[model samples]
Target: MEVHPANEFYLQTREIATGNVVGCAGALEVVPVSQVRLPPAPVLDVHAYLADVPYTTSKEARRAVTSSQNGIRGDAGVDISDHGLTLDDEFPDEFEEGLVQEIYRRLTRTSVSDIPGPEPESLVLGNLRQFFQCQAGEIDFKWQELYGDVVRFKGPFGEDRLLVSDPKALQHIYQTSRYDFAKQAERREVSRLISGRGVLWAHGHDHQRQRKIMNPAFGPRETKAFAPLFSDVASKLGGKWKDFISQSPNQESVIDMTKWIGPATLDAMGIAAFDYEFGTLDNSDNELGNVFANMCVEVFGSLSAKDILRQALAGYLPKAIFRYIGDNAPNHRLEQLRKASAVATKVAKELIDGKVEALEVGKGKSDVMSLLVQANVSEDESTRMSEEEMIAQMRTFLLAGYETTATSLCWALLEIARHQDVQTKLRHEIHRKEREIRERGDRGLSASDFDTMPYLTAVIKESLRFHPASPSTYRETMKEDVLPLLKPITTLSGKVITELPVPKGLKVVTSINGYNRHKDVFGSDSHVYDPERWLVPGRIEKTAYVGVYGNLLSFAGGVR
Candidate 1:
């Protein structure tokens, strides 16, 4: 149960490093948890102590306001007079009477309103405009500032939703009572069109089963084994770029990274996942690759009118009816996705058949597909994934395996390119590591090598923090619960509340962006992109339920 800060969030219990699997061949030696050292907790700033100002007077009252000028324009400012409440309904004379009578009067008359939150515009086509207006990701910070960590709002689907950014509340929902909340129904229904019932879409025991079967393939030991494959593919891409530049008379070529990374990642995925070669980087024409690439652009690239309409309809329409509409409609994107799914399925089936045949001939390779098929045909019927389930997983892998990793890699490279000092330091560290490897006669970078590189780890962590692939996601509560807050908030009625009561059907959308750069947690300089923050002791806050990776919600938490 050793956990290194660099890979803690990325590696799950399912991905155990020590295992008797095909790719692994045998158990790898485990690093003791006690031997893994993390940076010390960040020290608190002097100004941090000023966070506890009482709201007993108007001057001392706190409000989260977003203003363009020095002055706020509206008359709707929070009233602090008498703690912003009216006691007109209270029986003044009776309030001073017997204790029992006064208590009864107060209980019957007093009301506690919901917590204040950001106001969205009228449902012009069902909050579509509001959703689009929040393109800059600052809305989360604004809302958290104005209304405390947990704020209530009318969601895009015309339901009361809570957008929570508090770490304690996040821990409560994600870790303590994970089963009490399920994936947002609308999103899950739509996702099934692409992912089917893969582990990404499974819940409870079903999810656990899928993870168990697939764990060996994703374990740290197996992932480290794929390092050479990654390096070889990457080196080939570098060579391609060099040739392209040489072809240009100016000794420089404009390479569209958007176009380039996809193919390179596609090749990487093909080799690493199934030992199949797409050769996309070599400019080989791959039908499945084209379909997969196009489908990604159509679904996850941007939000068009068609996408917005389809998403809005998903909230109301039944999955079957909506799918029928998608199938029959004149939407080009929808049609492409359907074709893509068909192609992906056909390819997955062929690959699995090949692996099975290889196994029969006693020539099985140690790729993910072979190991998965091996696990499938074994005696453990309950843990084995059916053919359909395996295909669904294949689809998930194709989409998730390449796109997000490529995006993160791009961001990391961009950041390194922009910061010369950071780049120089990283290069020096790389040289040092190379020297050590050469001296030790190590063939390639190992898991231990990755663990020891602090600068490289910091760069990757900073990139992930700066730009999480999924900025926000929704969850619907299935059971009533109370969320504890790290910071207490004063309500409009002047009453201080430490816990919030969440209804069974309440919708919660967590802001990963906001939490990553939380001022209170990460200090006032949280918004800045400084990799040095990771080196500085006490710069990052300790959070109870901060996702899977090093207190970052980038990869999300819970079973995911």
Candidate 2:
């Protein structure tokens, strides 16, 4: 059942729906039941209410109050002494208090609420420049300038949307009350069209079931076993690059790493994810590679107005109309992507069938699909996934695992190229590791050897922090929630809020970019990409939420 935000007066009568938590409606004001048409509670010992409360040391509670006051209440537990933050000082200069007044007066008779954010210049057509900036790769600077830790604005559909950068609030959203917020429906729909009913687009129980079956294959042992495949694919790409450079008269070919990275990662994914070989590094016309490459060009390359219109409105169109247009329209790119999807679908089905047969014969391979099949067959009938579900999982992993890793590596290399000192230091570390390995009479560097190189690990973490593969992720609140603030914020009305009461159906954008560079959490140099900070003791501070691999939100936290 979906839960909605409601007033506190209804709390006694309102039952929280199964799998949902109702949001506190007017807790910001904490109005009494007597004022809301309910009989006042008998004035007995109010102290009894506190009797069963969990034990919290006064010092800890004081620290919490100091660090995180939303200003709605005075007793919000936060450690203010360490924060050195002020909400009034943080409000963007562009925000106009008069705009909120005008909005409440002219648009709706509802009471105006407090949150520090600039009223967009135009309500109906909100932030068109944001779309253009995202396309042009100039979004981070604009977002940083337009708002501080949190921003609220009218969305394109005239609904309220929020972009939050606060780490504490983010922890609640991503981990504490994760189920209360879900991936945006529209985004999930689009992903579903592209990748079937896979883990990427799955929600609730289906997602949990899929992840449970798939997680072990991606665990440390399997990942280490696949290391050689990665090295082989990377070496093949490097050898090709070397040959291309040597052929040039200047002995330095200007190659587009982006072009090479895709094929290399695809080949790696082929072996790692499915135990298949693409041989994409040696063959430009490799069927799956060509399909993917062509699809990328068709989607991202210059498009005619008609194609653009069709793509933009595809989400809103009926399923039949959308599929008809896709199948019959003059969209070469869409056709290629469709073909790639079809290919993936076919290959996944075949692989799963083969894995099932292999497992029956007690000769399963260590590839992800085989391990998953083995687990599925071993589990109880209730826990087993359908064959179609297995196929969907393969398609999801094939695309996501390779594409995201390749893009991140490309970004890391680009940063290394930009910073000569970092590159040199990294090279030295690699050489030192190689020497140590040779002295130990090892054939090559093992996963353990790689772990010994602190500098490389630092560089990768720094790169991920600076250039997260997914810059932003969207969520829609399924229930109203009270967001705890690490730093108290001053609302437009000048009231200090201790906790933010969010309305249901609210759209939120979690900025991975913004969180990675949060000032209070990471200190003044958060924006700077100095990997050596990781080497310094206590320089890399931990946050309320650490993501999947690192404290950074690059991989997001919880289920992701």
Candidate 3:
């Protein structure tokens, strides 16, 4: 059952076959059951709903809001809060007021409804952008801005999906009712394409079992041990880049980070995760590296209409149907996926075989895959994963450890390249820290030393905040539930709702971009790439636990 934000907390009943966005209490809009025609799409009147609302507790964000000409709502030439943030004194300008009543007149006509979520005026076409942005674009935050925190948008064939960003709402989805929600059938089917029935693909009890068996491998001891291994791989990458730079004219080269970073992360993952050496950084023409890189290109790089349609329409079918489609499809993207999946499976099997052989001959291995193998050889059958499941886990880990990490490094480098000041500051910090450490008789930075450098840590956090590699995730409700809200929302009938009523079988989307750049959470400049916010004391106060790392949705929280 795919659960949407409107359903988990804000239970909604939509007429999906028709174009009707049926409202339920606390979900979209509390609409009374009636045959009513929707009027013309009114002009954007953000001021009406957001009037006199405090944007953030962060002093920096408040300052940004006050300094802006049009204030928080971005109404261009209109000054919303002239004397600065006092509720009773501040009001939307006359031009803004006319805009509000006009919208109110147009909206109030619709009777009471539930889940009074702000929806796109252009309907299905409008929601298409939300899908794109949620995957890997920048425009999805606009939906959150236009709608309240919990937004209802159409997916393939006008299927309702609630893009949830509200902190309290996300808490329920991620923590309070986590087990109550399951992976959408489409997501699971798609996961099988690349990762098979790995931890990433499994849901419910299967997910719990896999995660419990594998989580211990990534504990503090393994993580700390992996650090020096990562540094060595990074040094190999740097050494290769230095050679490239030396060969160029003027001792300078335009090294494409994309070409280099993917392999570097692959090498790092190889040694750290499986104790397998890919040697991709050392050899530019590494065959396995090229295969994975080509796989990525075919999957994410190409922008053909066929690819886009396939990605958008991915959720339209279940696993059995998707399997039929994959087997029978005549063309490119699916074939590319199949090829990559085969290669990944083959690689996983080899790694598993090596580990099994090593363990049999009394050689102990400590890598993640080895750990799983150890569990499989355990006397307890409950702790063991099936052979296919083990292969899937390896495939999942390889892709995650290679592609996502590589993409993140590229994004971080891009940000550094764009901002010379940040680059310079970071460079100075690295050199200064190295010199300081040498003076203390230390050779170089340790795993712990990385933490001592504030600017470097800040930059990494900010980068993750801005560009989460996997920007969106989905869930479906298993049972009827109600969602509590951190912020109350107003319905079409002028009533305010705090908690939402939810029913089972609704599709929901958790937007990493929307939450990371939430105005209330990170201040008005949340959209801006300002690492200084992390330095400031009161910039981001507190919220529900959002991430497993650096307070980011980039590393999602809760169980798998």
Candidate 4:
């Protein structure tokens, strides 16, 4: 049937159920079929849409629709329209109650039967765009009310699509490598923009290889070497805050902690991760550092931009263009990336040259760059990294090692400032650790001390959980298959959905925020700011569990 593109009914049939034909023959007759029973339409609890439903044009739409309706309404007793028929007449005094009871029964049954409902005919692109336009604060409230950590909603614009927000489902998705769920492509695009072709952006064996190369740098010895650096950075920051408070005699000055902490973190990562000087400790406005700082801010802020610009194009813009437009356009991201690439490449080249010079001069070095340089120089042709790859790795180090830690630190401090008691306890722990170290005649607190600081570790874990820097990760289906999970969901539109016979290239989102805050695993107080949750026996407890943060999917997970 030739359908009107602008008509809602027409679009619903075409977009939601591609093979279903919905047409008007001169307003008097609905042609071709004497009777038409569309799929039992999925209902959305929320006013907005964000989930997506799969669509296909090859299926016999009439049979699929009939099958879905039968699943929802039951086959033996109900007629087609009666599938979604309200109980208004059945129980006049409690009509709504009866209808709700019927729905709940259907949902429960469907959940067990593993039958997905029809694609939601209601959720459209316009509705979704409007949903996004709503204030983020209001959206948060809406999400809480609709899902409340356990509810399911129709995907933004898909047939029989639903988004389940239960902790058990989240845990199942996170833990079951067999299902092979992954993050959405939009998130990957963001990762590529920030981290380039490093472990964060790579997949499968490439990701594994990169992780192997980088894993040594975060080992016990290397991590211990960085404790002093962390202490130094934290101490300097505390001192700076003290000075700022002291200067505010009237308490009129309000510090933008995010601003200060961002740079401080850049500085810390430089020393701790690469043994390079960012000079943020001295509050020195180094040219390269400033550029780096600005670049980070720009990419994050681009979340609100309207234009969709390719990341490559944004990375290649001239520095002058970035300086002129600032963070206003997609081009700004490109320019920032370009500058970062240049700066990182230059540093890598310098490190390589320095390693060569050091070898000639007969000196040994222990820093990460030195190790990487030595490895690269000594490797045979097959294993050796190109200069470009070396630079990419260095850039990845700077991007991944610094920003996340800094963001986490910022959130931790913010939470502490808000929860003075937690702050006081943390400080006491820090002081006690320091005293113990001094009593042992240790010049500095050892890495063991950092590990032993229970409250401090708890504080860090809680902060990471509450305000994850990378709130989501993306992955794509490598093959079509059924995904088994703890909770089975029936789509709004009916279909037997399992590992969603997902086409090979379909994108999926691994929502860190949603997974971390799920109530089933975390308890009813999942939303509360409680560091005690991370502590067991007055020490930071490590256990085998599935989550988005601790043993969670905060970092990407896959076969490789």
lDDT of 1: 0.67
Candidates 3 and 4 compared: the better one by TM-score is 3
> 1 or 4: which has the higher TM-score?
1
> Which stretch of 10 consecutive residues in model 1 shows the poorest summed lDDT?
53-62
Q: Give the per-residue lDDT digits (tens) of candidate 4, residues 1-560.
A: 22211111111122223331221111111122213323344552211211111111112332443354442221121222323332222434344333333333222222211232222324443123322344322333355345343232333344222233344444445565533555444544455555555555566556555566666777778778888887788788878888888889785578887778777887777776566676865755665556666465675543422332332233235645533344244465566766776676676677668666886687746666666665566556534555555666777777666677667777788999999989899999989988998899988776788879989888887887777776654455556433444444444444333333333544443456665565545556767888987775423222225543464445533332
lDDT of 2 by residue, 472-544 (tens): 7878888867787777766665656656777677778887888888776666898788898778887877767
Best by TM-score: 3
| TM-score between candidate 4 and the true structure | 0.66
Model 3 worst lDDT window (10 residues): 2-11
lDDT score of residue 266 within candidate 3: 87
Q: Rank the candidates by TM-score, best first.
A: 3, 1, 2, 4
lDDT of 3 by residue, 405-444 (tens): 8988999999999999999999999999889889999765
Which residues of candidate 3, in runs, are more than 4 Å off? Answer: 1-126, 133-137, 300-318
| TM-score (all chains, Cα) for each model | 0.76, 0.75, 0.77, 0.66
How high is the lDDT of residue 551 in model 2?
A: 85
